[model samples]
Target: MDEDSDAQVMLRVAAGDRKAFALLFDRYHASVARFAYRFVGDRARAEELTQDIFVKLYRNAKAYKPTAQFKTFLFRVATNHCLNEVRRGEYRVTRSTSSPADEDEKGVEAVDAQAERPDEAVAGRELERAVGEALQGMSERERAAFTMCRFEGMAYRDIATALEASEAAVKSLIHRATLAVARKVEALQAGIGPERSRA
Candidate 1:
């Protein structure tokens, strides 16, 4: 079925349809988990968060409104949960440590940094680390906007709906986030070049 059909299933779920809820979960579980992983940067925690999100959805299904798309509502719930976790310091500890080499990192590679040689591969990894650090430094809203826009390829209007912000505000958040990440990456690369020159 087409994605828009998920909203119909959600409406059925609102009316106490167990099968509909299962269908909804099956349709979105992976996407939600991936989004949570991007926000939290921990696979286990992301899985937990995804489970929590689905549980919340089940409980709140009666409140579902078709005023917007179902995906928008789902992301809105996910974003709020992630931001709360961030505020509660659940993710802060992980953010302090460097991201380990993981399969999940492949999903967050919004930039296509082709590295043909061994040195370039090392540089690519360093650049990815620097970008991850910069992301950790972003404010919750900025990070959310950047993730949705860059990693998820969400449109600004959809992001604004999920974030409850104006489209202009979302644009500004993403632009500022991009500039901040770029500056941090350049600084990191500058430091790396000097060390390499000395070697």
Candidate 2:
């Protein structure tokens, strides 16, 4: 459904409509799970976190105002929960050791479908690993912004709202994070370690 429709469903959820809540949950569950997975880097923990996020959304539905896109509101909730959990040391974020085929099965991250050649597939895997390493090294805010912007395809303004930061600040976070990831990926491609690449 479109954002307007999602907003209307959320309003119904706020008014105690069970079906509406279910519908919203069905619509966004996978994406939220993917977001959580990216944050925690573990499928099982990400699933648990996704469930908690939805429960929190249901409980706080009354506080939701349709001032922005429904996604912005939803992700704001997700972002806060993830950052809080990380800050509290509830779970440490680590790179997933799952192979490309495993990630494809779980829909966590997709290997390029066009990468049929062995070398192309290897390059894709290297790039994915480098990006994951870069994300693990980032500050929470930078990681959040970069994931939303690059992976979730969120716009800068939407990310700013979700992050409760100014657009300029979101842009800055994304820039630094993206640059780091890019450098790491480039280093991998150049047959160098990221630290040496930085040097």
**Residue pairs in clash, model 2:** none
- Minimum summed lDDT over a 10-residue window in model 2 is located at 105-114
Model 2 score (lDDT):
0.81
The CA lDDT of each predicted structure is 0.78, 0.81
lDDT of 2 by residue, 107-130 (tens): 324224346889976666666666
Off by over 4 Å in 2: 105-113, 193-199
Which candidate wins on TM-score?
2
lDDT of 1 by residue, 164-189 (tens): 99999999999999987787677766
RMSD of each: 3.9, 2.7
